[model samples]
Target: MKLKKFIISSLLAFASLTFTSNADAASVQTHRVQKGDTLWKIGMNYGVSVSQLKRENHRTSDLIYIGEILKIPQTISAYEKDLLARLVEAEAKGEAYAGKVAVATVVLNRVDSDLFPNSISEVIYQKDQFTPVKNGTIYNPASEASKKAVNEALVFRGQGSGSLYFYNPQKTSNSWLRSKQVTVVIGNHVFAK
Candidate 1:
């Protein structure tokens, strides 16, 4: 009788664990925002708060591009697929993976410093800082390489070269950079942490 009770308890515990795992797996999904979609609409559809959607998607501005993919916490399967897709895109278009990570790190650092916006979009879109925003590069529909680079940077927390600054050798000439020294150079960019 004792052996039978123990077996039943063990089986019950295992079944409960399996059910919980499945339930977690079934939550979360990725939705690519279309031209007509709004944050509120997406949030309502996903049964999450609009603020949550905006925060998770890292949208500083109210406006969103047509082709941008928004991750929704509706199903785990969709979330993973979108996450993988974004990672691939970042790597493919990222001309300087090292440089990209450095840039990301700088933004993150700034956010932590309390001298800059706390969100990724806010940091990247800050005035006169990032070239992509200033020159419309950020809105240029990021290349696959860039997407991959960004994903790698986000995932790995910007490792490699430890560069906190980079410059185009062809465009910049200053005593400061020369004094700073080089940490790593990738493609047309240089990085320093």
Candidate 2:
């Protein structure tokens, strides 16, 4: 009887473990396109980016009809989002709103690039990649606008200019960085590839 009870407990434990894993594995959230719904509007409504929406739905254009369903990718976790926001807050603290988005994009671009680390934390914390991580400002609470900017960077969904690096020209004399082709100039930050 004791052996049978032990076997039952083991089975119950395995079932619970499987159920927990399945719950954690639930990732996709679907949104059926509504009348007058634009990708930007849908992304804003769902706290995702329009670019992500298009990519996930296999759409090359912004056009979507009513009753069309979209797969929302939640690959980036809350902690990663918060970390990114904090980096934006620290890096582009006094820059324009567009600059803030651009700053976040640099990190995201690195994440996508095979040359850099694959994850946000890895990219941000890698060696001398970001000053905020080195100076410890990355742990500070991200401003509401900064957090919004990070989401917009990840989802605001305009095809990014492929900027891989940004620097304050006034602050950095790194000739190699300055020598790279400049993509866009926003306030004090110069974005380059």
Looking at model 2, residue 142 earns an lDDT score of 93
Give the per-residue lDDT digits (tens) of candidate 2, residues 1-193.
9999999999999999999998876755888988898988777666677777877889999989999788886647889989999999999998899999999889888888988999988999999988898899989999988988887787754478889999998989999999999999999999999
User: Which residue segments of model 1 deviate by more than 4 Å?
Assistant: 1-116
Alpha-carbon TM-score of each model against the true structure: 0.44, 0.81
| Clash count, predicted structure 2 | 1
**Which number leads on TM-score?**
2
Instruction: Tell me the tens digit of each residue's lDDT in model 1 across 71-112.
Output: 874321333323333322332244545555455445445554
Kindly provide the TM-score of model 1 when superposed on the true structure, using C-alpha atoms: 0.44
Worst 10 residues of 1 by lDDT: 75-84
Location of the lowest summed lDDT over 10 successive residues in candidate 2: 151-160
Question: Stretches of candidate 2 above 4 Å error?
Answer: 1-27, 47-49, 156-158
Q: Best candidate, lDDT-wise?
A: 2
